[model samples]
Target: MQARVTGHVQGVGFRYATAQRARELGIVGYARNRDDGSVEVGMAGHDDDVANLIDWLQTGPSAARVDQVTSEEIAPQSWTDFQTG
Candidate 1:
C-alpha cells in the first residue's frame, strides 16, 4: 500500500528510520519528505509488516513528533529494495 504520512515528519530522519525498518522486515519500497511538511511512503509487503510500520510511525524518530497518520490501500508497486528519497 501507498501511505502519505503527515505532521512533523520531516527533517527528523523519519525517512531513514523507515527505510531501515522496512528493509529489516524484508519489505520493499521508498520514502521521501514532501514539500508539505509530510512524509510520503510507498511500501509493498505482507499486511503484518505494513501494519507494523504504520503503527510504529505514530511515534516516529526521536526527533519526530508525529501528530497523525493516515493510510490508504493502493495498487501495489514493485521496488528493487527499500530506500529513502
Candidate 2:
C-alpha cells in the first residue's frame, strides 16, 4: 500500500516510528517526509499487515496529531528492509 499521512506527522518521529513498526511486523518499505509537511509511507506485506500499518499511520507516535491518512493499493515493490528518511 501507498499512504500519505497528513497533519502533525512531521517533526514528531512519525517516520522513524513507522520504520520501527514495519520492521517489527517484518514488512518491507520506506517512510519519508514530504516538502508539504506530510509523511509518505510505502509498504508491501501481507494484507493484514498492510491494513494494520495504515491504521497505525492514523495515530502515529504520541507526539503526532494525525489529521488524515490517505492510502491506496498499488503494485507491489521489492525491498530488503524498511527505512525512514
Candidate 3:
C-alpha cells in the first residue's frame, strides 16, 4: 500500500518512527518527506500487518499531529527492508 499523511508530520521524527514500526511489523517499504510537508509511506507485507501499520500512521509518533491520511492499494514493490529518506 501507498499512503500520504498530512499535518504536522515534518521534523518530528515521523519518518524514523514509521521505519521502526514497519520493521516491527515485518513490513518492507519506505517513508519519505515530501516537499509539501507531508509524509509518504509505502508498505508491503501481510495484509494484517499492513493494515496495522496504516492504523498506526493515523496517529503516528506522539510528536506528529496527523490531520489526514490518504491511502491506496498499489502494485507491490521488491523491498527488503523498511527505510526513511
Number of the top candidate by TM-score?
3
Model 3 bad stretches (over 4 Å): none
Instruction: Compare candidates 2 and 3 on TM-score and give the better one.
Output: 3
Q: Mind giving the per-residue lDDT tens digits that candidate 3 earns over 1-85?
A: 9999999999999999999999999999999999999999999999999999999999999989999999999996999999899
The digit string of per-residue lDDT tens for model 1 on 1-85 reads 8777777788889999999888888889999888889998889888899998888878878898888788888886768899898
Between prediction 1 and prediction 3, the one with superior lDDT is 3
In the order shown, the candidates' Cα RMSDs to the true structure are 1.0, 0.7, 0.5
TM-score for each candidate, following the candidate numbering: 0.92, 0.95, 0.98
Give the Cα-based TM-score of candidate 1 against the true structure.
0.92
lDDT of each: 0.86, 0.91, 0.97
lDDT of 2 by residue, 1-85 (tens): 8999999988888999999999888889999999999999999988899888888888989999999999988887878899887
Off by over 4 Å in 1: none
TM-score of 3: 0.98
- Error at 34, model 1, angstroms: 0.9
